[model samples]
Target: MSNKQPESPDSAEIFERITYLSGKAQQMLLDFWTRQEAPAALTGDPFGMTSLWPAMTNAALSDPLRLAQMQFDYMQQAAGLWQGFLSGDVPEGAEGGAVRDKRFGSEAWASAPAFQFIKQAYLLTSRYIMESVGALEGLSPREQEKARFFTQQFVDALSPSNYALTNPDVLKATIDSGGENLLRGTEHLLDDLQRGRMKMTDESAFEVGVNVAATPGKVIFENRLFQLIQYAPATETAYEVPVLIFPPWINKFYILDLTPEKSFIRWCTQQGLTVYVVSWKNADETLADVELDHYVREGFLTAIDKAIENTAAPAVHVIGYCVAGTSLAAVLALMEERGDGAKVRSATFFTAQVDFEDAGDLKLFVEDSENASFYGELSEGRGYLDGRYMATTFNMLRANDLIWNYVVNNYLLGKDYFPFDLLFWNSDATNVPAKWHAAYLRDLYRDNLLAEPGGISIDGTAIDLSTVKTPTYIQAGKEDHIAPLRSVWKLTRHFAGPIRFTLAGSGHIAGVVNPPAVEKYQHWTLEGTLPETLAEFQDAATEHKGSWWPDWLNWITPLSGEQKPAPQPGEGKLDALEDAPGRYVKERIA
Candidate 1:
């Protein structure tokens, strides 16, 4: 204790102090500059006599009448807008493009001319700034990306939805609640601050296995990396080729089996296909050294072995969603190297991209500098990336819907959180092992390695997608921001076998989980040879009503082989560990 040095300020405190001092210094500098310029500005030579006159003379000579007319038009528009506000005759606000966008749709916002004007002004200003930034010259690609990102962040932060006084709904709620709403909101904010992150949904509204992930099944196999659940068959005899699902480890597996009505697992079982899903364990400190090889070996390969043994099927049909599809493709490459490629009869990828060349907006976060900073910050304690960090990044991609919507509801209005199953699933996230995450970013995202031959090795064999010849069915969401349709469509170039690509309506999660019973959303399908480009495919595709699930079932059923008696859970050496939606899924990192 005597030898110990005195405590110093933490990084956060240091940054706060630096920010305060810098802001104060900036204000002082502005005041000094204003004082210096005051006399010149009053004398009407603020920009300097020579420069101001020359610039005006050049402008007048160039196009004086057009410039004058443009200025007059802008002034007239401004005056009209102001007059409309005073007369309460402002036009309706622009419609928000996002599905969850109700910011400009409310009667309150439309009725208030001031709010209407402000909203329109904000929209116009943000659009102009964004367009200007996009058209900026003489900047490197990376600098341009950074500029766009920060500009968007500033625009989002300044949104009327984020402020109480400027937001009509929030103001109305404040008045109606007699100031109690703000008190409740304060409590909510304090609670979130203490918890260290915002709660996106009412976590208490649904319980795992009780209401959600309630499909009847049993954990038939377990390994260090994942647990395989074999669902109880809805039909007596199932397809001879068992269907195994590899869901993305970034999320809990129950996203496929949220509830009976919408559950893809239940639908599969009902359609006479024995379904087995891999429920990955949420990573922690003890599992920090887990690498990509371990996942391919112990997680996917092992699960496939167990499923084949239990069902006594020579080959199985595989479905991989999101990152799992990427992993499956890698696994297939490994399998091809091992001469064991025949074990899988057919493959289906749900919104997964093997090629990362056009990975969409997510590429912005995968740059060298940003990736390095993320690695350093996340590797500090447990050597694992916190689930909340991933959740926050994804949420920021859609700030208006995922972040600010809840902020207003939970804090400004003091309303109870809506019990949405999808949002609940979205909120329940899982951590990623540091080693695996780093490798994934560097190899797949950064280097674009997976698509190249010998770019990556798993279990001592180099992974190459070209060698994978399994008949493939690829599904992509047209509106998916995470895995863009073009990125998903790139898989056709690498695969040597017959491929069927279906483009679905909606986004990543909703597109894949869509059940036919809902009878919502449309999907596009095209027969004959795949097109050379995404645009051509879209142009030639035929639109079909209803979910893509039914279309998928129709496509796979033909290849599934003749029906056989459904295999019982734990028929092989692996005994049934527990009921469906087992203990592993319930284990949260925090």
Candidate 2:
């Protein structure tokens, strides 16, 4: 109305169509819409998609700009295909080349999506060239032309092969910096593609599928939002010692019980350990009132109390991973100070941090005034952290692999989509309550209260890990980015009880789930006692050349009683319980 160009109705319609198609394609690959192993069909690798498919596909499919960007990039690749044919790099003149020639040599190639991408890239470069020359307008005409030519040369030299060798040092740095495998793995994929070792497939969206989808036995403990799954012991009977596993609410608990061969839960069950996992209800806006303390009280402590009441055992073991590990440490510290130590016999922390001093680069978020302010504003209106935004931040942390690799593949190669389990899990993000997240950032990261005796409080009760006298086994990864190993080791100094510290071979997820089958994996040594510092410990400890799973088994076996036949249901301390491994199946909270 004010002399502005009218909105493109066609563009909007096309965008909507693109989104719908992408989503449909994604669901097909995910097997959410149909049963198919998209990754295996495309890459011939069952594990290829792990956690990247859904992530990249969802980004492209849901957002109009992202979808458009993808379309434009594909156009550039079409140009390259044409150029390859014209240069005789692709066959178009031989006996069978007639068909190929007809397909690739047509004038219609100019309008192809791949060609459009090249045009777009060329235009962008042209803009940069103009800007560089305009800044030197006072220069001679010869100098201006040279500047333009040099910029063109710069773009030409930015090919993948040349770039790889040019930044070998930086590329190798990730291996030591905890992000090596992620970056290197992506480079390997791209390398295979460029070398023609692997054929490029059509990738349109992320694909995820249920690997071991099973109906949980039944729900024994039902709440308004949570239905705890009942699990029958895999063996004839289970241990008298009751155990509860509390995984981070962001993911499904089934990650721990992923598969029969790789499942930690199944392994523990076989060890005669009665296990129950706390599958936290996912938090949405309506669940905003559910704060951190509520999780501690209504969620964790309640479960613990119930376990103790049912088992009538002196105490139980609680294992927490990542953020849930922090929660476990807090609960243990609180219970001990209140002279309620009888409910907990031991605690095992998997990459948990009670100290914030060496919290790693993640501290940057809480420290950045601008970022924190923006987050605070977002949290105020949302009542909880946006699940997708949290997922995006994590993805950004590994930009080279998660962000750029996808860019080149989808835009440059015109690759087809695939299904990946890990990517699906990664994409399945859950929101955190604003109150809890805010307090967590302020108290733990900003104030470093959890480590201090009276720094952080829960309803007037101080959280001091040092006060916890429970025998503990703390395991951390040497290459963990989220919770640095050093910060995890600091817990040893805090607990007065006998403690065992172990280091694994890989980064966060792989390290925690180290199945002993990993290639050339090693662990820190164990001598007369665990070392005081993480650095000193690494230097002194021998690198055991195998998966740490066997070592973990041996270590925990002693803490647990011998392989005595477990009592039948309703016969031991846990006699009052409904069943073993009760009401804790994996499910998405809608």
For every model shown, what is its TM-score relative to the native structure? 0.85, 0.62
| Model 2 Cα lDDT, one tens digit per residue, 74-160 | 556546546764663532221122233221233323344433333333444444434433444333443344344444444433423
Candidate 1 residue lDDT tens string, 1-590 = 49989776565665565456446545654654565422111243221233423443453456656556655754565566667667877534332342235766667665666777777666655665566556554455655665677568778878887787888887777555455566567667656655546776787888999989999889987876788999888999999998999999989999998878989998999999999999998887877888898898889899899888888888899999999999999998899989999999999999999999998767766755446555646656576777777887788777777788788888777777778898888878898888888788777887999999999899888878998999999999988988998899999889888899999999988888889988889999999999899899999999998898887889898988999887777665567899988988988654
Candidate 2 C-alpha error for residue 380, in Å: 6.2
Q: Tell me the lDDT of model 2 at 308.
A: 63
Best prediction by lDDT: 1
Which TM-score value belongs to model 2?
A: 0.62
The alpha-carbon deviation from the true structure for residue 165 of candidate 1, after best TM-score superposition, in angstroms, is 0.4
Model 1 RMSD in angstroms = 12.9
- Which sections of candidate 2 miss by over 4 Å? 1-218, 222-230, 368-372, 517-520, 562-590
**Worst lDDT 10-window in candidate 1:** 38-47
